[model samples]
Target: METPVRSARRESAPLRSTLVAIGLTIFGLLGAAIATLPAVLVDPMLAKGVAAASIEGQTLYMILNFVGMALAGAIYLAATGRGWSYVDFRLPSTTGWIYVLVGMGASIAFLFVVNIVVQLLSLPAAESEVVAIVGQDQTMILIMIGIVVFFNAPAEEFLFRNVVQKRLYEAFTRMQSVLLASTIFALVHFPMYVALADSIAATLTSLAIMFGGAIIFGTLYVKTRNLVVPIAAHAALNAFQFGVLYLAIEYNVEGVGTSPSAIVGILPSLPP
Candidate 1:
């Protein structure tokens, strides 16, 4: 015997959860954009003289991006009367650690397969703008490796997995939540490739690859119910890719074109 008021509330719950998820997704992107403003504006005026594209400049940008996302996440939690307690912050169990390793292996294997498919089809996969600056500079690549490990991976996992995906769980099935969150993750990253992707095909290919990476990340988060798993997998995959980049640059390996950016753009590397 459901009362009318109770029925209305039940009907609205999913809608409310949906709207909240959308809002948080937008905020995740907006936070990164807004948080990096200091790098875009004030940092240039300071005595540091860090060019926005230099390794130091990019590192600063990433750090500020994380700060912005953290602020945005905090604001959301506060508005909802939720807090850090709302997220599953527990350490991974031994089983969770196994999932983490599996996630990394799966993601790497996915990227390798994607490269082969793209080449077979002759589709151009766009690289991140950062690729140009960090291309062959072992020093810069090393710095970026550190940035991805510490700042980039955690910030993205915090926003997409801990925040966005978690919110959607209230309204959707767990797999649906993972899927929707992965889509949002890909969409948020779509703009970074538009100007540089060369064509719609290339841009879409890049987005699809990133979408797959997010799926891997989201699936693992749902599977383990722990943020640390996805964060570790994401950070490890990026670190490995960058490490490879370092070796390629150091050894002058051929055929290592800008594609590595596409492979690791799951970091969804921020725009320049």
Candidate 2:
């Protein structure tokens, strides 16, 4: 009887794994669709004559993305029978404020360096639309940065690093799980830009950068087993980006472009 029961349990493990994978995949797709629904639905409606359609679309997109990711995370936790307690909030022993400061410094320095390199190499910036948006309306730009740097970045860290990566790490090898989650993270941003040759090239390049960053962030989470470090780091990086944009717009920096060099103050002719 014992042997039979053990055999039955062993047989069920694979089935359970399959079900979990299916659940996660479905949840992810559903989440993505729901998150983008505002852009899909509102953009057209606004085209017809909605007041502040652009702002409405942007606001809705941010809201839906947050809500969709949260819902998906909840579903994932439920399906896996993992209690909320499993979501670790432990910070590193080094101290929270120290981590925040270090993260901020490191992220800003890295951005500064990368911006210099990109500018020297004449590489395109990740999102040109962001520049145009900032140029048109500074208030909107600030709102966008608030959403992305603080809210969206933290939410993403929670969902991807904490929830998805944590679950997958339990079920699979650490490296495999990290790679998988990072791939998913990069892929999620696929349709944010146009699909033309230049756009596609830029998108792919940005994904590669994001994937590399995700790996580092994911590894940090695994090592610390804490969400706070990665969250801080992610937010820091985003805030740095926003600051760079603000400076660029304020200075009417032209020809300085999105290249790393332009951002890092390497190009003498570029605006400070």
Residue-level lDDT of model 1, residues 8-41, one tens digit each, is: 9988987887778778877866887687777766
Looking at model 1, which ten-residue stretch has the lowest summed lDDT?
43-52
Off by over 4 Å in 2: 1-26, 35-52, 90-93, 120-135, 193-200, 255-272
Clashing pairs in 2: 115-260, 115-261, 116-260, 116-261, 118-260, 119-260, 119-261
Best by TM-score: 1
Error in Å for residue 242 of model 2: 1.3
Each model's lDDT comes to: 0.77, 0.59
Q: How many clashes in each candidate?
A: 1, 7
lDDT by residue for model 2 (1-272), tens: 57988889877764564455445645754774566566657576533332234776755655566657666776777776876887777655776556656656765665566556655766553554344333446565567667666556666777777777776765567777778787877665455433311656656665665566677677767667778888877776665666666666679876444442222111001011
- In order of appearance, the predictions have TM-scores of 0.89, 0.72
